[model samples]
Target: MRSNVLGSAADFRRGGHSSRRPLDSHLAQLFMRDLRADAPPQLPIFRSRLQGELLARLLLGPDREHTMLDLAVMLRTDLGSVVREVDRLARAGLLTLRRTAAGRLASRDTATPLHEPLAQLVMHTFGPKAVVAEEFGALPGAAEIHLFGAWAERYSGVAGEPPGDVEVLVVGAVDPGAAFDAAQESAARLGLPVHPVVRTVGEWRDDTDPFLRQIRACSLVRAR
Candidate 1:
């Protein structure tokens, strides 16, 4: 009887209790595959850089009101392009324009069921890798940079809440003052706190430290 119980346990561990697809709530491999198969494709949004970036910003801060000029300036794109893409997205029902007391504001349409899912997809794919690379690429003495914590987990498609902060691990003898200053500027732009943790290569390689071990266990996105 003990052997029989052990075998059943092993089956559950290796391939699940029967051959049927696991429940979605369980988050098993089969369940995740099924979820992906059932999900609507988001390839259209990614086809255009301007559209993709605009959607990302909208989803990132759904509550905030975005103007045509504001989005154009933030994305570093031309006004004409921003205006065209905004019209397209608005027509597609992904965004809505409101005549506010201050001016016109473009905001994500929360009423659509696609709002949450689309946001998750955009954030999972285009999270913070590009921004981090652009921010820290030219920093002196920074040999490598990695993104971990909530952002990394979301980027890897692990279901979680939107990241409230950006955490990066820099493996090199980088300047903390410079790192802090850069992080502050990045945080201001991103509307979230940017934290850069500096560590030597040797320190990073040493897995004996509890914090390092924990970092090693989670998903990481390499920026450099």
Candidate 2:
């Protein structure tokens, strides 16, 4: 089903874009089809990271109808802690809170129509090179996916624009060839770029100057 849709979309992209971004219009729509079903994937579950994630979510817009106490329960934290954070977040201008009918402290949805800004941000901040490298770090043994090259930058966004682009580096033992061809076909259709780096465990360990490092200049050092 997906393949057919993608193929049709690609057929429509004869020359609508510069480079390979023509598929973006359709693909972006497809990817966004169910994005808001549950926005939890965007949050950090770690106790320490929760505050920042919540704050980011507010900046990105979470339901403002709910109060901070409701949010505290959702966050599984004490109401007092949520209140403190709410105070801090409000001061930062990322969120606004109000008392709900249930007497809970809820956050105001200050988030703009975010998908566009977020997509652009993903691209602008990561750049094709660093985005790919970081992707490999998460995927492990991801060197083969590099074949996508410039297309990777297409999805990941140009080094600093952060809009209309998203870079993803998939490592692990996934088949690089299959992934590349799939991405190529998809890129031709949806126009999103996915730069992958797939390698064997041996390849990653065999050389100190890993392929990922070849693009080292592009990335911020991964947090240990």
Candidate 3:
């Protein structure tokens, strides 16, 4: 089902618009308002990192549901902010809210025509942060993980073609083999190539290294 949605999104982007419907006027206006606000460097499509992370989690896996507390923990945000964003998205018709026995649960509104395209956009843009964080955060001796290169450039609002792959920098004592395995897993989950370059903490801190210096000059989205 996930693959189908992603494939459909790809096809939708390739002139497969006959079946696509326009967004509701009210929803469009709401989205426009959100977009007009200052966006985060990690995912410039949305006004804030919280918004991007929230939408990416809900939309990318529409079948799953999460409570406000669950979302807060997963997103590393406050409960108040999660509640506000959930309310806003729910009002926009992008998410559905319901009270369960445990608590209020939020999930993607699959009924919305915007689901597919929006999910695709999230998958390509903000997806790397979430996916990479999950995959590499637990690596032994990994002190810091960052995303750089084409994907980082686009995410930082540099206009260009969509990134074909994700570039990652792992700084710590983690084994190179472990980093490679994590990269492979992340690539599989994202449907894009993930290239991870492991550097020791000392190497990353060195300012004289041309490669490290160049990476520092560009946008680097921290994953862990």
Candidate 4:
């Protein structure tokens, strides 16, 4: 399995369980597809470039309201650095400062305007049907469950104006074989590879699962 796709050599490697595609996901081999051109341009918010990406990711959803200490650990920086970044975000008008006992840390107050561009890219290039099929629409019980990760990241990442396209790894229910088939077909139809690893609630065990373990090591993109 590939490890910490954003931080490790895995991003450069040709193939892996996470990176590989079945015939159905895109319907054909992903063949030399370099989509950087199709991806969005970097934002000015990331310009001050003080690990603001982490701040952006944290703000993507209401769920990941991390403390200053949490941001400290995630950035592999000191509390002071995290605090500084929070201040930067506040000054940029992207965040509002909220105080608990933890000094001045910024609170996410609004939806990012940056999200739609990436979603639009996915929807435009791949088409909404494929985005929904390869993403939310086709997944069985996705509405019933949390239905996140690789798919949710489309909104979360772009919505957060993350450093890159949303890369998701979600948990949901499906007839394992059929779901996989749909994912394959959807990807083929979209002309790009969309990867997903679905496990049932009962089947989704501890971090020992290869994917989760890699994720634990470096889902730098996962808000927290």
Candidate 5:
């Protein structure tokens, strides 16, 4: 029965809804495949970037229900993809889904055996953005926060080794001391070093500094 549900979920991904192929069948092979084992090590544990982002958002923080629209908008992906992935996860027992007046809601299934370990894995990899956002988002006078360096590069799809630490750039009137405290908290939460460098908005906009110029040349993932 479980296999049938999983197969039907796969069929949904294939633009069909009626097929009930076996779980191991070509069309019904694992919803989130281990295909990324050979891919460049950017969030390499997951089969696709969407998968990583979706799981990270749902698993890395407080367990709460989210509508499909919420996940799609947060991840900046299409609704169809989010719905499909949510359905796949729900069928796999990693997520639970139910209908409400607002729409279908999904949340991580804490009872699943994979929940704890998978959340831990996500916390170390795709978890940085969520952690940083939550920690630094409320900083008074802070205008912009972005993730840069190897982690940002990897998150932006630049192939490289997994990042050892997270580098953050804060641009605004934020106090350096407060930013440092936030970084420390984020690092503690993620089990990885988080370095947040503060710069005045004017300095960030200045094109004369070689360091700022270098940063502009690379990928920057907004934390807030």
Candidate 6:
């Protein structure tokens, strides 16, 4: 049933056009068809780290509304950079900006055809580390946090897709149960699996096992 609708939409894309049906409608249908079949389309690679980070926070983070000034401070980037990135994302149909009494506000464009799927992918790829840093930093016993595996490699600019699960290492005397509970909460919120390996500072420093050695040698994103 869905395929027939998609076939008609594809035909429209090829040539057919009507005054009653607008271009955006056809495009939305086409995008919906694609979403029905596979993962979301890939977003363009961002040249600026701050730009990427900003988008991830807007779409994947818990909050929906942010003023440009607030975003600049939160991302620790300059106001100019934040404005530029917001403009770029707006042009790309990935974000929506509106003028509010407080300031220029930005939020994800859920109305866009590809919004939900693209958001899921972005959150799965970049959201874990952000969530880990935000959620665990305040834990009483946590001393340090690290992200390893494919996500870490990609974050270090090695190039990789979002992995099935995020790998996290916590160095502290934190209760394993508490840490795992935190992981579970983060996972539920981020729409991705979170695998946390909790170890004492001494255990992490020992690095005796081959896996530990490899993880220690590779690029790691320190969450704390």
Per-model clash counts, in order, read: 0, 24, 0, 14, 0, 0
As a whole number from 0 to 100, the lDDT of residue 105 in candidate 2 is: 55
The positional error of residue 93 in candidate 2, measured at the CA in angstroms, is: 4.5
lDDT of 5 by residue, 57-77 (tens): 787544578899888777776
Top of the candidates by lDDT: 3
**Candidates sorted by lDDT, best first:** 3, 5, 1, 6, 4, 2
lDDT tens digits by residue: candidate 3, 1-224: 12333454476458676676866787556544443445667666475767887887677532668899988877776676688679877877899999978989998898999886787788666698778988999899999999999878866667666677899999999999999999988876554688999999999998999999999999988878
Scored by Cα lDDT, where does model 1 land?
0.71
Predictions in order: lDDT: 0.71, 0.43, 0.78, 0.44, 0.75, 0.70
Candidate 5 matches the true fold with a TM-score of 0.48
Off by over 4 Å in 3: 1-126
* lDDT head-to-head 1 vs 6, winner: 1
State residue 100's C-alpha deviation in candidate 5, in Å.
46
Error of 3 at 104 (Å): 36
Superior candidate under lDDT, 4 versus 5:
5
lDDT of 4 by residue, 43-145 (tens): 3323232343344444532323567776666445556556655655565555666777766455565566744443344333333232434344556665222
Model 4 residue 47 CA deviation (Å) reads 3.2
* Model 6, runs deviating above 4 Å: 1-92, 95-126
Tens-digit lDDT track of model 6 for 1-224? 13433555587668676645565766565444433443222333443345555667677534458889888776665576577668767877888899978888998897899886766556544567667887777677899999898767766667555466678898899998888888877675454578888888888888587777888889898988
Question: Mind sharing the TM-score for model 3?
Answer: 0.49
For model 4 the TM-score comes to: 0.34
Whichever of 1 and 2 has more TM-score, that candidate is 1
